[model samples]
Target: MRKPRWWAELALIAVVYAAYSGGRILVKGGEASAVEHGLAILRFEEGLGIDAEHPLNRLFTSVPALGIPADFAYASLHYLVTPAILVWLFRRRPAHYRAARAWLMTATLLGLVGFTLFPTCPPRLLDAAHGFSDTMAHFSAYGWWGGEASAPRGLGGMTNQYAAMPSLHVGWALWCGVMLWRYGRTPLAKALGVAYPLVTALVVMGTANHYLLDAVAGVAVMGAGPLLAPYVLRLVDRLRETAEASPVVSAGCETSAGERIPGQRSVRTTADDKQEWGLPCSSEAESLGKAR
Candidate 1:
């Protein structure tokens, strides 16, 4: 089996990420529909208290400090936690890398759609509400949090700050949990498989980085991809089977490669590459029945 060239692999990642980032810039810059969604969600908060009276929010916000002011702990964790978790996911189950990448890309698209449609403000931004101070003002925050890039009302920034309806932190953590449960089943792995997301849910609520409905949106986005990715993959797969194959690119990764021949040029042969898609693994059959 020929191997997938590193350059080709890098090229694929670059193209995908570039599209992902560009999509974010274009969508949030408009804040088209996100305003309506944001306002509606904000209304839900009217009956409940997000301040000192809400013990659930307080416990989530306070646990990280162990006594110190937890806002920074909450914020710091919010900022730093995702990349590390994603890194672990990729390293532990590289087999799911493609699916993981697709999930993230889809969520970004969904976020932009939300931003454009429902441009709403977060609790921290609600001036009429009592006991709300822009926590970001006191703590160091991301250079670009949302719509602060253009006029206060304009949508010309890295993101639609109002796009908080889908708690991506929840979405990604749930994605991580499902992937571990499906592909990396071990005792500790299974426990964390559950815990990481529960903690992430806590992180979002405690920090007020997201509202409850945002978490719901995140789950919704993740669920949508399974239905959507299959149809997309069918198109890619039709191109994969012409009996000419590469060493590095797996026939299973997408559907455009040819049959396996013993030359290693287009594939990577990583441990994970071998486990799931090592299609082109052998030239034994033209096309075979997939396992159940």
Candidate 2:
């Protein structure tokens, strides 16, 4: 197979991000539904807690600025860490690009879906109904993306303003962590692999940008991406098969067992061919004009 290149994938990423941004900007801001949804979630979580005075929830609700000092650490996540890791790994580890992109895109799609379906406000706005006050009010640096001009206006904020459940911030960290752990060799990378999600969990919690459940959902998305990607591809493969089976189709060659087909040609049986494309040989196939 011809190896995939990074530039094409980067271009694709741009397109995906633009689409995501555009779709998100369409939701109504300051919707009452958002507040109600957030309250319901809070109540559900309260019910599920260890007890009425669930220590974690109590502490979490009581301490608004829990992770405030770590705001800069959290901010650096999107602005620096994730993109850098993805870019560097993209060039150096071409083999992982497709899987990584598929996972990332799946997570993105789910996140957008969450925004549409369950538009809950973050703790910043969850005070009245939840009987909570600003735990993150003092943290000026934390709300960098909260303001209007700071966010990219994609054809006018079609986005859900209060979509805080399933924190993509936490989801991305988990994604990066897992990918790095699976594919990387370096110790520092591996260390970051374990630490990224943990740190992100803290960041979101401390700043009250997300509830514990949002982080849970984020982690769930990252974990599900890889597992789900194959099924997604199978669906694509099925569509291609269906399209090809139509009457007007001139079918491509189907190689017999143990045969390696060239990109340009096909055969039913194995044979020694002339050229090897310098790729690691995988099966019995051939091309023209080179050493044995």
Candidate 3:
């Protein structure tokens, strides 16, 4: 297979970002439904005995210094780390690039679908009675983001605050982890692959940007992507092979009585009477010539 071009990859990344941002804005108006879904998720977490988001947020926010870093992780690392790892994979491990890229895109698009369909609000956006503090707000002056989530202060109104289900921050962090762990040559690299995602999962929950269940869904989506990609790729390969093998029907090269004749192939014998069927193999053509 041909290697991917740098310009094409850059363009594809830009397009994907544009689509994600635009889709989030378009599907973000369902506030009441989002709140209900977020509440339902919290209740479901309690039922499953994994209600950690609230306490995590409370603990982290109790320490402003710790909360600042967690907020930074949510706002910046979620956006930066995935793309950086993707570029590294593309350049360093071309053989693994296609499958990894497919998995990432599939998981991310699935997250978009969840954002549109479920539209769960984040813990920070929940009622003040919930005791959830918006850590990003508390540390907004330290970073580029506004009092809300990671959007710029001026552009905060344009972002999708309610699109919180299936937390992509955690999902992307996990992707980075998988790539580093699987491909890294050193012990430190492997350790980072495991640590980064774990840190991101905690950071998202601690910053009130995602629920425990949302991070769970994110991991589930990432897991499903690789499982489904192989089948989809196999189907595509079959279709491509079928297309290449199918005969190409066209008008005959020679004319008869000023009209084209059908059933005649485009290939012809050479001037030396050597049979050629538009293929370049001399031994095969010699066999055809002898058969003729």
Best by lDDT: 3
lDDT tens readout by residue for model 3, 1-292: 6688988888978898899889999988578889999999988888988979889999888998789988877888877888899889989998999789878887888889999999999999999897799999988889999887998888888899988889888888999999999999999999999999999999999999999989999999888889888876677679977776554323233332323345666465453432222323345444554576
On residues 165-284, what C-alpha lDDT tens digit does candidate 2 reach at each position? 678888888888887898889998789899988877866665556677888888887778888887776786789677755443012222433343455343222232212112333243
Q: What is the lDDT, from 0 to 100, of the residue 15 in candidate 2?
A: 91
Error of 3 at 123 (Å): 0.6
Q: Rank the candidates by TM-score, best first.
A: 3, 2, 1
Off by over 4 Å in 1: 1-11, 29-36, 45-100, 128-133, 141-159, 239-292
User: For residues 162-209, could you state the per-residue lDDT of candidate 1 as single tens digits?
Assistant: 656566667767876776666666888778778877777655555455
Model 3 earns a TM-score of 0.82
CA lDDT, every model vs. true structure: 0.53, 0.63, 0.83
Residues forming the 10-long window of minimal summed lDDT in candidate 1: 144-153
Q: Over the full model, what C-alpha lDDT does candidate 1 score relative to the true structure?
A: 0.53
Poorest stretch of ten by lDDT in candidate 2:
269-278
